[model samples]
Target: MPRMLDVSDEVRAEIGDEEAARLLAGESAPGSYDCTSCRTPGDSAQERTSTVLFIGDETAVLAFAHATCLPSQVVQVTEEQLQGAVRAIGGTGAESPQQQYQSPQHPQQQYEAVQQTPQEPQPQAANLVPEQAVLGVTSGLVLLQGELHPALVVEPTAPVARPGSLGSGDDFLPLLIEQGFMPLTELAGVPPVLHGWSVLLAAGQLHAVLQPSPNGGRPVAWWQAHQPLQVTDGWRAAANKHQQVLMFAAPVGSIGRQPREDLLRDALDKAAANGKLVASALPLAGI
Candidate 1:
């Protein structure tokens, strides 16, 4: 039987005509899948489906989404991120240092993990402060130039400090720029895919989302939780299958806490409108 499918040029290029033809023929496609964008159920045989391809540094994965949620496109990712996604999909444990200490068996262990600081006080860099600031992040999908793009809206709860200049007003955007985050003057196209940063989704939940470091060392978690944030199963499935995630950041007061996804989206729009948004798209690697 023929199925309703739409394969984008980017996806077709990645998967080649032969594989794409098989998918369109339903010979190498799943009958039903979770929509990559909205995490809703979609049936390729019954309704229009889009072929979304996730291309990592080392491999590529084909995924399906509803035409309404996300159009067919090729998402670029990194090899490490792809491996982590595979592990998550296969139910293999790839625990982070904090995760290892956050075992449910020991409440004390979890407490310690939360309080744990880096061994030896690391010296402050340019655009860095000695004191750590907790950043609040809200993530949602946004339509840009007629394309659905995953975006994260970030804001620090308090004014960020600069080294030896405590309370000198929020230097958050400058700090981010110093760390390689680019401010968005326009949203003409997706920002250049930033490297060494990713949003971690595992076990049908939103885990730690990361930010790039100044030293070009390991990326640091920008948002982590005492307990992982619960999310729709379809969201986690899409994260694992796509193996790529996009992140956006802004300064203090650029965006605020919203109780619902709709409100969060509005906040993102406001930030973008104010010209206070910085964005990056990275592959899903280990936390």
Candidate 2:
């Protein structure tokens, strides 16, 4: 046999039957509870007695401090605020705010009237480029494959021809002219581009290569150009071992009429830091 549970009048007056059941069943805590806002360990009785009512679901709980003690402002809520709150909480089907209030219908209307109307075009960061452009650059890098091998291989077509270009030296300059950028497809199995030339990163730091350029001809090879690679996307993983450097070119007017090597170095360094250098092969030599 179980002993009958005794109910106190004070408890019954403070919280209704449904909430009381919930509190007992561990679904919720009693309304008159200690929180960081309300009860400091050494607070006086006067502070403790300054109770505020937090009502919800037809039940009210006593908080041991005034509404000002809580971090949020205590605005007198209206029908619209109530509706917004309900929507925010996903109605009774989801978790709702633990507290609510009821006021005279006229006062509620007045409160709703005083609520600041939402403004159009909320302030946001201005986008210099569309989201799609950024995404395209990212996707292109994902498609490129191979280790970054750095070697000063002559571009098939170029103003400066490699030794024995007609026969002995590989005529890579013609390939560069035909293709504005390096075709990543050609260097799938080769080492990363860094293997050939020393990369001067934007951060004023130098990443020395495993192999020096043939004659130190503009760090990168002509064959590896026009490929979109982001530094952030792991340059070493995508560069061809035969290629010496990964040149990053700026857009038209980005570096004025002619692109400076110093500017390229600075851009590369920043890209490296931000992890934004996705393309590996761009024509950065001369221009």
Candidate 1 worst ten-residue window by lDDT: 111-120
Question: Candidate 2 on 152-181: residue-level lDDT in tens?
Answer: 211111122333445443223233333243
Give the whole-model CA lDDT for all candidates, comma-separated: 0.56, 0.26
- Candidate 1, pairs of clashing residues: 81-284
User: What TM-score goes with each of the models?
Assistant: 0.50, 0.17
Please write out the lDDT profile of model 1 over residues 1-287, one tens digit for every residue. Answer: 56698988766665567656777897767676645444456788999987765444445455566665556765444445444433433233433221112222222321111111112111211122245666665556656677555555667766777777846677777877776677776555667666666665432335466676555654555555434444444444444444565567777777776787677767766787888887766665422
Native-structure RMSD, model 1:
13.1
Which ranges of candidate 1 are over 4 A from the true structure?
1-132, 211-219, 237-242, 259-262
